[model samples]
Target: MMRALCLTGDPVADKLLTDDPFALLTGMLLDQQFAMELAFAGPQKIATRMDGFSITKIAESDIEEFVELCVTKPAIHRYGGSMGRRVHELALHVVENYDGDTEGIWTAGRPKPDGPEVLKRLKALPGFGEQKAKIFLALLGKQRGVQPKGWREAAGAYGDRGSRRSIADVIDAKTLVEVRAFKKAAKAAAKAG
Candidate 1:
């Protein structure tokens, strides 16, 4: 079943992320230095520019030309140039490491297919740190239903059910607001502590 994600206000953009695992992964990669909705919408924008979201295509694309595509009009990210490089590199990494099948990273083919292994794999990806990897793992479990064993433990606080603290908990506009508030509070706490 395709899960409906309303993170991007635009239905088409959100649909692209929800329907394509690669797109979802790309969206997560783009989540930095940009608003959540805009970051998630990036894959759709790139698909529109490139005419598809094929990992092979992105990996093979010329870096300079891809950067131009990423910077045109409503740019893919706040820092389109660096982000364009990151996205292209990520596509190459996916192709080389996962055989161009983003699903393989989390699916049955995984050696362990458990939360810790999944987090380890995510952390190995470009642009993913410990916190980002854990949050993505939580998003997989909470929204995409990719719960391997010990997923909750691997995801840390983001795995808690009913927690409106991240994109995983965002189901609608109201929840989006809640997630933003939670992020704000967390940021403040980090700064204070």
Candidate 2:
């Protein structure tokens, strides 16, 4: 499963590493409605424009500008007429509690809450529901202390609920090791050739 994730270019599946946890949280929030590809593009574009789109920069940004960028340039999530306002709310929420600092927000939320508790807290946010909440928990859990809702159970429950959410089970760590070894040997053989 880990190999499949790495092989697939899905960034969410990629083991994301961040010194600033708020950035991960914010990026995950953008992913709620945005297609994965577009969602991946949003932060990069923002970072390019601001020279570094950190939580502080985003929180300090005028809501009008955030809305404008959300709607027009490098548009990722389509929140209809509601995109700007919703993101404004999210940015403000982060700022109010986190002093507009990415590291601070993550740390405040840190020592990482238990998986279920983390899910509950995130669901309390304005736009999130069970599915979105699960997605964030799953993604963040992979990198942090949280765990993906046991894969089989999440899939069964989500499927019953008609949820499109795909939780992974059986991460094939060995496959990754094997594939990497194969690649190394192939590279060596080619070089020898």
Candidate 3:
């Protein structure tokens, strides 16, 4: 069963995230230099503006047009132009690598990839880096139930049970506040160090 996500406050946006793997991935990709709720809301904007969201459609879209859609009023992110390009590249990667199945990054292969392998695959995505990939892996294991062996270890600190570290741990308004507080404190500590 697919668990509902409350990353975006908007019910429509949150529903999209819960029902669409690519949307969730796109949300994670956009979850940078932006507020978490709005970042996760981006896919719904794209879906509404484009009439629908499809991996192949996005991948094959004209770059200029897609960027324009992304940078429209209430843009997907503060840096909509760059993020739009990144999203396009991500769609292309998904189509080429996983035949447009976002879940295949973790669920593919004969033996079914373990947690580390899934992390490796996620890290290879266009906008995903080390921490982002790990957080996303943790999100999958914790909320989306994509756990493979060693998942907790592979996710590093983000996988800690009952932790309020990242989006992986965000389940409601209260948890969102907790995560924000945690991130703020961590940022302060990093600066003080």
Could you say which candidate leads in TM-score?
A: 3
Question: Model 3, residue 33: what's the lDDT?
Answer: 89
lDDT string, candidate 2, 115-136, tens digits? 4555556676656677766655
> What is the overall TM-score of model 1 with all chains considered together?
0.95
lDDT of 2: 0.50
Give the Cα RMSD of candidate 2.
Answer: 11.7
- Flag the better candidate by lDDT, 2 or 3: 3
Total backbone collisions for each predicted model: 0, 1, 0
Order of models, best TM-score first? 3, 1, 2
Model 1 residue runs over 4 Å out of place are 108-112
The residue-by-residue lDDT of candidate 1 on 1-193, one tens digit each, is 2367788889998888788998999988999868998999999999999998878999999999999999998999999889999999999998999899998888746265888989988999998899888889988898887899999999999899899887878878889999999999999999999
Error of 3 at 132 (Å): 0.3
Whose TM-score is higher: candidate 1's or candidate 3's?
3
Ranking by lDDT: 3, 1, 2
lDDT of candidate 1? 0.88
The candidate that achieves the highest lDDT relative to the unseen native structure: 3
* lDDT string, candidate 3, 149-182, tens digits: 9989999999999999999999999999999999
lDDT of each: 0.88, 0.50, 0.95
